[model samples]
Target: MNVISDQRVRRGRKFGQVLDGARKVFMRDGFERASVDDIAREAGVSKATIYAYFPDKQLLFLEVARGECLRQTEEAEAMVTAEVPVRTALTIAAERIVAFQLSDFGQRMFRIVVGEGERFPGLGRQFHDFGPGLIHARLVHHLGSYVAQGALRIDDLDLAADQFAQLCKASIHEKLIFSMTETITPELARRSVHGAVDMFLARYGVGG
Candidate 1:
């Protein structure tokens, strides 16, 4: 690549360091309490450098939040494609998603998006595009293939796609996020997977 492209890449990497530090500070300190100065100090960059990348603390927070969402979605998509049993693939994806969203990082991200979304218009859309949007698309593509091969019965591909994802990821996930639930043991994760698959099959499986 040319020098200008190289410089841009380097700058992006450096700014990414600031964004990473900002996520930690915001999560630990909350968005209102986190200062741009603190984020800069944590990232080992000057406040001016932070400003160059992000106009203010809120923007910095959103950038980090967006990156996290995109990252987790990519990870989830990858997890879904490994050559495991379809049930097992769905099970592991659900567990990883649960862990990603229920962790301190995840809760902080959820709060940020819900609280400040009006102030930042695209935060939700970025997530919708990469987070659930990408996952739903992938599920439909793969599961639709199964339908074509006579492995599953999916008359409404789009709706079934949405259901497959919601079923796989939503059960324990909803409880953990909204219900002040405690830890999810491996046994619970496994049980959630098995239970969700059985119920989903009963409703959507070809033989049913």
Candidate 2:
């Protein structure tokens, strides 16, 4: 009768608590040193409970990081529409994504992935495949409409999206994730986003 599964009914808070705990443990101990037992104890759950939600310790941490990526990815996908216009949507979407990815937690996760993922390659691929590649696909799909509507020239929409993502990365992720630069201001965010969109539109926008 209670076959709905132990992980579901109250999983909302439990999973969230576990994820939060895991982020801290992972951040403190590093992936190799952080233990599932410690994570479950910190989250006030049994080790089996952690197993119910995540296959392994790294996976548990991966889920936490991936959830953050998904939040940003969903926000990026929200900008696509026939009415918003491709360039405008890209600028706004990029601004939001860049902010999320460059935030403090995002930076830590980035560092962890870059530092540890060399040995645990799947973890790195997981973030890259879903977080960035998926966002780029949606961008290309939306930008394709502009080409059809005669606002942009004929070419690969996916390639265009890749270029747009690169532009955003140049403005924010490159500095935050790669360079370990200082924090960026909202004003700087807007300026960077606008300039990237301007360059993109200039390349493909029909008139010039």
Q: Estimate each model's TM-score.
A: 0.73, 0.79
- Judging by TM-score against the true structure, name the best candidate: 2
Positional deviation of 146 in candidate 2, in angstroms?
3.2
Candidate 1 lDDT over 1-208, as tens digits, reads 0111111222455777887788788887876678887888888988878777665455565566657767776776676643555666556556655566557787666776666567656666654554456666766787776677565777898997777666656556667667656776777766766776777777767754
Tens digits of per-residue lDDT, candidate 2, 96-181, equal: 66776667776777777778777775777766664566666666766777788887884877777878777766667666755656
Task: Note the clash tally of each candidate.
Answer: 0, 0
User: Candidate 1 at 44: error in angstroms?
Assistant: 1.0
- Scored by lDDT, model 2 comes in at 0.71
Candidate 1 displacement at residue 60 in angstroms = 3.3
How many residue pairs in model 1 have overlapping backbones? 0
The numbered model that scores best in lDDT is 2
